[model samples]
Target: MDAGAGRIGRALGPGRRRRERPEVTLTNYEAVYDFYGPGRRRDGFTHPLLTFVGALYAPEVRIRPETVTELHRLHDAGVGIIVAANHPSHHDPFVLASAVYDRRVRFLASGTGLTKDPLFRGPLRPVFEYTGTVPVFRAKNYEGTERAVHDAAAARLIGLCVDRLTAGGVVLTFVEGTNSSADDLRTLRLDSVKKGVGQMVRGVRDTGGRVAVLPIGIVYRGRELAKLPPRRPVVSAGPLALWEDPGPAPSVDEVRHAVRAGIDDALTDAWG
Candidate 1:
């Protein structure tokens, strides 16, 4: 592997796969499903869009130097990076975006929230796919939606993410599957990682790609209950587990639990 200079390749290259249907918005769920396939869209706009996103959130958070270094290290190695992070608030996407502004990153977004939540149906609707966010279906989606629909959508979404990482991209996801809704921001439930992380790891390995997991802790003070807003929240990347050649394939459940442990340990250490 050409593990070198990850900081050098932040711009989007040609033939980026994800896209949106400007003609038919997310409200038209049928159109969305049709338009949301692999290699269907382009990233001609993501670089600049990310620049704006990073700048917008820069003032709200302080990314740790070591975390930035870790990102660069993983990218330089030219290996797929899966960032399993905590979800404290909706603002996390912005904060995390700002932290990894220099890397080719994608956020795993919630299809359920987008399709079901009234707030996202407006201007925010486009935001889901605008900045390279990957929408995923889960059992947690809209009521009455068939399990088969989510199953099919999730399978396709996972394939798309695997392809992106196979091409040596960085993907960030909240391990808890959704925001913690915690009373404060000091601690998080890292043990509660969703199923995607393990799926990604196995997919990368199965598809002839090297992958690694980074346990990142979002640390800050002064949330809604405090005297100030999160003027200097921190995104700290640490306690990583790089790709290793396991003699034989491990079950998805095993990979999931191992990742959970790594993330939980990292978060616990950071929280203290």
Candidate 2:
């Protein structure tokens, strides 16, 4: 068992037993890609599982009222939204889902999150699959031919997100690409926002579809170390920044700057 799980298991004491790790059938990247490909059917029926887990772990979530109103307005207007948020813990996805349950946003998740562990592969995989979560394979996780395969898969996933945006769907992504320590929360400077956000925006612009990026800041209260299932994390949403192309499309750096500014504003709200 991983150290984190081991600690939780010990904390459960003799009275509570850890559930047996379920058997995982999808073990390879090809299998995972085939199963979670964009063409597959996703009913989003398992989305409530995110809410259930979020409530169980972060029951006292606080969200800005105005932010909720703004999100509703955007959704009602049929605007494609890309929810950009900082990733401090694995629990951020669930907590954010609980905070914005009404949006019914699809998550852009790492491929490894689905197939890395038995627990994820068995029980939790369905939640992602059925909830329309887009799994992206990182080439860094593989080598040689495997790396090339992942690279192609990642490209295809980007296209899928672009298509979703063009179709006026809501997609949530962690702009930082990787989780950062909560200790850095005070600094307020996010890890360099990845180029993927810019690429997605460019893709949408290329299609001449209207899309906006919504920045969400997640702050964990009284967190000294990175822990699973944070305690009472606060989610703050900033105003939506629309990226439209009337002439030449905005450069990737420009998009990145806008996203960064939006995230900064949301972070300020979260800390305030």
Candidate 3:
């Protein structure tokens, strides 16, 4: 009974995911990962090995160096950058990270998927953490719990990290919060912008650091992965949204529109 499962079992009634576990047995995931021994199939927990393999085998499945150069230029600007992008596929984070190569960027990930899967919980979870992914807890919590147990104050905490790296670094946020189904803009799903971006902006201002947002749009030539290798993905980097005020962040709609437009341009130029 890991703390999370125990918490879930106690709170979600008798017949739930945790009910499958024996009454007294606990889920010691660290031990499970140790037993499994890091393997190539598990990309979530395996760290350096997995990262190296992913880069080697999928070298062609990456962002272009030109895109990376533009990203570096934004870093050279000395403003904190929040990469608000659309999630068109499962490899979205990899696409973003490949372009960001070597930059100190952190990703705010949805906690639901990573924590729930046995595979991720066991052999592949470290890769998730090592890549600067701090999962955001979105589940509704039991009484007396202010926020979801897994994600309380996550946004605030990540905001602080952004502040600490204020001079230059990337904070990748999928404005939709999930993968979009089509080229058209999807409804922004993370709710309206919360205090996270605002807190980061204030921290940067107080420290005399600058803050900006880069809307990076990624488009798959054929969206469908079952298709041939003829369709290479394209990423478009838009102009930065430099913060002029230390107040609330841009609404999700605003970021979505910007990213969509950028992707449109990038896709048109890449294959046309």
Best by TM-score: 2
Residue 17 C-alpha lDDT in model 2: 57
TM-score for all models, in order of appearance: 0.69, 0.72, 0.53
Give the lDDT ranking, best first. Answer: 2, 1, 3
Per-residue lDDT over 1-272 for candidate 3, one digit per residue giving the tens place of the 0 to 100 score? 67987888878877754323111111232333332222112335434543454363242222456655554565666556666665666666555555443333212121101111222445655555444454443333223554443343444444444554474655566655555655333322334234444454555655666666665566665653433222345555555556645555555455444555554554444444
Give the least accurate 10-residue stretch of model 2, judged by summed lDDT. 108-117
Worst window of 10 by summed lDDT in candidate 1: 108-117
When superposed on Cα atoms, how far off is each prediction in RMSD?
9.6, 11.1, 11.1
Question: Which regions of candidate 2 deviate over 4 angstroms?
Answer: 1-34, 39-44, 59-70, 102-122, 143-150, 181-184, 187-191, 224-228
Model 1 scores a TM of 0.69
Candidate 2 yields a Cα-based lDDT of: 0.62
Q: What local lDDT does model 3 show for residue 133?
A: 50
Candidate 1 collision pairs: 3-77, 4-76, 6-76
- Candidate 3: worst 10 consecutive residues by lDDT? 106-115
Count of steric clashes across candidates, in order? 3, 0, 7
